[model samples]
Target: MKLTVVGGGSTYTPELIDGFARLRDTLPIEELVLVDPAAERLELVGGLARRIFARQGHPGRIVTTSDLDAGVEGADAVLLQLRVGGQAARQQDETWPLECGCVGQETTGAGGLAKALRTVPVVLDIAERVRRTNPNAWIIDFTNPVGIVTRALLQAGHKTVGLCNVAIGFQRKFAGLLGVSPADVHLDHVGLNHLTWETGVRLGGPEGENVLPKLLAEHGEAVADDLRLPRTIVDRLGVVPSYYLRYYYAHDEVVRELRTKPSRAAEVAEMERQLLTMYSDPALDEKPELLAQRGGAYYSEAAVDLAASLLGGGGSPYQVVNTYNKGTLPFLPDDAVIEVQAAIGSNGPSPLPVPAVDPLYAGLMANVTAYEDLALEAALRGGRDRVFRALLSHPLVGQYEYADALTDQLIAHNREHLAWA
Candidate 1:
């Protein structure tokens, strides 16, 4: 099978390459293409990718290209991990929102909306090209604002599934804590991308015994620490919220802390500088330990599993993925993309039925779903009013005044990326 990675220049690509190398038997790639516009970074990452593959004794041929069409042509799957604007734009996305007193996150709040607007158009153009080249190829999107991006891809009638590492990361962590293999742990992970909750932890398989209560009872402090939430909160909720929820549960506190610290984008930019320097070394053939601190933990495993299943290869029968709700969560619209456990195979992911959601989480999910609708509309058709409406719809920026200011800030910081602006 052939696979193409858009944005293969990203520092995160090594993680994916490592996964592809280790899981070669599962996916059996024949050709791998790395597509990116940054020729220098692409060379560094692509070289390391080849070395890693060779080091692992994988026979797949690796190629790098700046031409998106050529790179994706006739591929079995095209994985989208592109950042429309590099870390420089992300720095603005993560900083300007703070000027409006909102949490300036790359994948949530006003910043996330800015990223969505910038990313959707570019991704659609690439998807259109991919479709023209190979209509049968599956598009596995690992892009940020995944819920919005995946929605755009689906609405455009492309064969796509959004992937995230959050579920897999949680499974691995929980397994480590429980003294079990990661594969033996199953999470009742639910909600939208980034904004999700682990409603249950089943051991052995999807239908395995629920050990969540036991986990909480025995390791509440460690779990809470991982999430950066108070143990009391976890004990009270009887569920674990993804770390992203902190921006909501403690919005003001997080905003305050963000104001004090450098934007995560800035930190990542520096990290990338260091990582690229390391990638330049001809002798470094394996993924560096520093990449662990770069985030997207277990992303390689998640992407490989999703790609394998999508290609009709045997992989985990069930995994968490971002796809159409199809009434899995009765509160969400059928078209709304949600991250949940699903049976994966040749036909793609079919979300399993989820138990009734508590009003606490359901209400937030519904609110965010509405905001995402407006965000997507704003992304598709650009205008200040659309931007304002989307911001106002967000629970994080509910006030009209804040929305007005944020809309202007978003546009000002991203004018170069926003054609309408």
Candidate 2:
């Protein structure tokens, strides 16, 4: 069996390769293919993969290339981890939405729409390559805004699965806080990526009721610690939330009481200022990197865990990831990407059926749908109308009367970043 990783030249590629390498015992794959646009980046990853194989004394083939069609040929699984347009593009995603009176966070609001518009086309192109080159392969997409990208692929009739570690990572942390092994915790997680809530968490050795409330009451902070969510946000959200809580809590009322609100307009202005100054000031380019160098532990674990689960090495239970819910989720459309529990094997992921979601969850689902639909329309149609509709439908926008002014300013603020002709 062959496994191929697209966008193998990314800053995160080394860790992704390490993820697969760490699972060498369970998945005895014949070859590892790394495909990217830049030969220099591919060479770096190729060298690393070669060294990993040599250290392990494995004779498996490690092929690195720039050709998409050739890279996915005869593949059993293909992992998509590309960052289309990179940091400069992410800046646009972060700043442009705030200019129009919406949250400018990259994974939410107009910011996410901007990201989806830039990402979907490239991801779909690779999906097409996978279709042609590896007809039976299961596309494991780890791309950001995964819900959006996965929907696009499904719409195009491709066999694909979106994978996000958010739910699994958070749940594992919650289990640790309760002094229970992750293998013993069964939780019901629903909603879109980033905007999710756990309805229940069952504890004890496979035959017990939920112990989450007891744990949360006794050791909240310790439980929250493992969640990786900001402490300030968790303090307000009233639950062990995910790191992406910043985006979801940005719309929560209790959170607003806890944190000072920043003017979207001001933030947008500041981002534009910083971006301009950074680009024009040559000194900014010469500044030393501030982050301390460290081993790639977090980055490497995700893909390795996933690959292990896929190969059914008795790794942790398959955390059902990006899949639609027909009857599985009452709050969302059956087709919406809802991360639930599932079983993973060499054949791929199989989602578990879930009970109906709570009524409150329906509202959250509706609010997210507004943004998701707007994003899809803007990406496929490329116009101000869809973007405008998105802002109007936003849950927070309805609470404020400045929708028109916000929309106009955002359209103009994001004009350059937007691809509309």
Candidate 3:
């Protein structure tokens, strides 16, 4: 099978390449295309990709191109990982929202809405091209604001599934703590993308015994520490929430802490600069250790598993993915996209049934689902009003004053990317 990565020039590409090279039997790729407009970055990443494949003795041919259509043509799948305006835009996304005394994150709050507005249109255009060139191809989106982007793709009638490393990362973490294989730890992962909770951890299968409470009893402090939350909170909640939840659960504290530190985007920019330099070394045949600090840990593994299953390649049957809810959550609209465990196959993901949700978590999920509804509207039909409304509805920016000021800041910082700005 052939696969295309649209943002193959990104510093994250090498990590993905390493996975493909290592997991060739999972998703046997015959042709792997790296598509990016940034020629210099693409060459650096592409060279490393080829070397990784060769070093692993994978027989697949690696190709690099700037043309999106040409790159996706006749491919089995097209993976979207592009940043519409690069790290410079992300820097603005991460900083501007902080000016409103809110969380400055790339995937939620005002910053996430900005990303959604700027990203949806570009991704839609790419999806259309893929539809035209390779109608049968599955579009796996690894882009930020994945819920909004994946909703856009699905609404436009593209064959797509959204992938996030959060579930896989949790799976690996929980496995390590339980002293079991990652494959054996099944998370009762529920909620929307980025805003999710591990309600239960089962071993063997979905019907297997729930060991979440056991994990908490033994490793609550460590788990809470990793999340930067107090152990008491984890013990009280009785569920492990996504780290992204910190932006919501501790918005004010996070904002205060964020002000004291450099923006993550800035740090990542420097890391990318250093990573690209390392990538240029002809002797470097593997993904550099520094890439681990660059984030998206286990992203490649998640991508491989999802793509393999989507192509009927005998991948893990059950995995966590973002797809149409179809009533998985009674509180959410049927069309709303939710992240949860699902049975994966060529037809796409079928969300597994979930038990009744506690109102505390369900209420937040419902609130964010509404915000995403408006955020998607802002993204699809560009307007200042739509943008303002989306911000106003967000739990993070519910106040009109903050929403008003944030709307302006978002527009001002992203005017070039927003058509209606």
Candidate 4:
């Protein structure tokens, strides 16, 4: 099968290439295309990709191109991983919102909204081109603010499914703690993309025994430590909130800490510089260990599994993905995109039914869902009022004055990316 990666030049691409090489049997690829606008980075990454494939003895032909249309033409699937404004823009995304005395993150809060506004249009345009080029191809989106991006694609009538490493990351963590294989662990992972929780850690399958309580009882401290949350909070919730929750649960504290430390974007930018230097080495045939610290842990595995199932190859029958709710969480609109476990196949992911959500989590989910709705509206139909309303709706930026100031800051920092501005 022919597969195309839209941002194959990203430093993260080597991690993906390593997975493709190791898991060749799961999803046999005949031709792999790397598409990116930046020719220099693409050439460097593409060379390493070819070297990795050769070192692995994989026979797939690797191609690199700057032409999006030609790169995705007649492909079985196209993976979108582009960062519209690159890390320089991300530095802004992770910086401006903090000035409003709020958490400045690339995927949630005011910064996330800024990213959504910038990303959705570029993704939609690419999706449209992919649609026009090959209607049968599945568009696998791995962009940030996945819920919003996926929702935009769905609304545009594109065949797409969003992918994230959060669920898989949780599964692997729980499995390692439980002394079991990662495949044997299943998570009752629910909520929107980054705004999710592991309510139940089931072993075997969806209907398997829920071992979440046992896990907490035995390894609460370790789990809490990994999430950077207090053990008391984990014990009280009886669930593991995603690390992203810290931005909400400890907003002021996180803001204080963020103000003290260098932005994550700056750190990643430096790492990319180092990684690119590593990638250019002719003798380096594998993904470097430093890539692990670069984040997106297990992303390659998640992508391979999702792609295998979507492409009609035999992969795990069930997995966590971001797709239309379709009433899976009765509280959410059927059109809302949610991250949940689902049965995967060529027909696309049908989100598995989730048990009744706790009002604690459900209320937050509903609130964020509304904010996402408004965020998407702002993304599609640009206006300062829409941006203001969306920020006001967000739990993180509920105060009208804060929302008002944040809107201007978001617009100012992102004027180059926002055509409306």
Model 1 residue runs over 4 Å out of place are none
* Per-model CA lDDT versus the true structure: 0.94, 0.64, 0.94, 0.94
lDDT per residue as tens, model 2, 95-138: 54444454556566656655677788778878888898777887
Tell me the lDDT of candidate 3: 0.94
Predicted structure 4: clash tally:
0
lDDT computed for candidate 4 = 0.94
Q: Give the per-residue lDDT digits (tens) of candidate 3, residues 1-421.
A: 9999999999999999999999999999999999999999999999999999999999999999999989999999999999988999999989988877999988899989989999999999999999999899999999989999999999999999999999999999999999999989999999999999999999999999999999999999989989999999999999999999888778889999999999999999999999999999999999999999999999999999999999999689899999999989988999999999999999999999999999999999999999999999999898889999999999999999999999889999989998887
* Candidate 4 residue 112 C-alpha distance from true site, Å: 0.3
Local accuracy of candidate 1 as per-residue lDDT tens digits, 1-421? 9999999999999999999999999999999999999999999999999999999999999999999989999899999998988999899888888887899999899999999999999999999999999999999999999999999999999999999999998998999999999999999999999999999999887789999999999999999998888999999999999999999999999999999988898899999999999999999999999999999999999999999999999689999999999989988899999999999988899999899999999999999999999999999999999999999999999999999999989998889988899
- Candidate 4, residues 1-421: lDDT per residue as tens digits? 9999999999999999999999999989999999999999999999999999999999999999999999999999999998989999889888888888988999999999999999999999999999899999999999999999999999999989999999999999999999999989989999999999999998898899999999999999999999899999999999999999999898999999999999999999999999999999999999999999999999999999999999999789999999999989998899999999999999999888899999999999999999999999999989999999999999999999999999999998899988998
Candidate 1, residue 277: the lDDT equals: 97
Candidate 1: lDDT over CA atoms?
Answer: 0.94
Rate residue 35 of model 3 by lDDT. Answer: 99
Return the clash pairs for model 2, or none.
100-410, 325-334
TM-score of each: 0.99, 0.79, 0.99, 0.99
What is the lDDT, from 0 to 100, of the residue 210 in candidate 4? 98
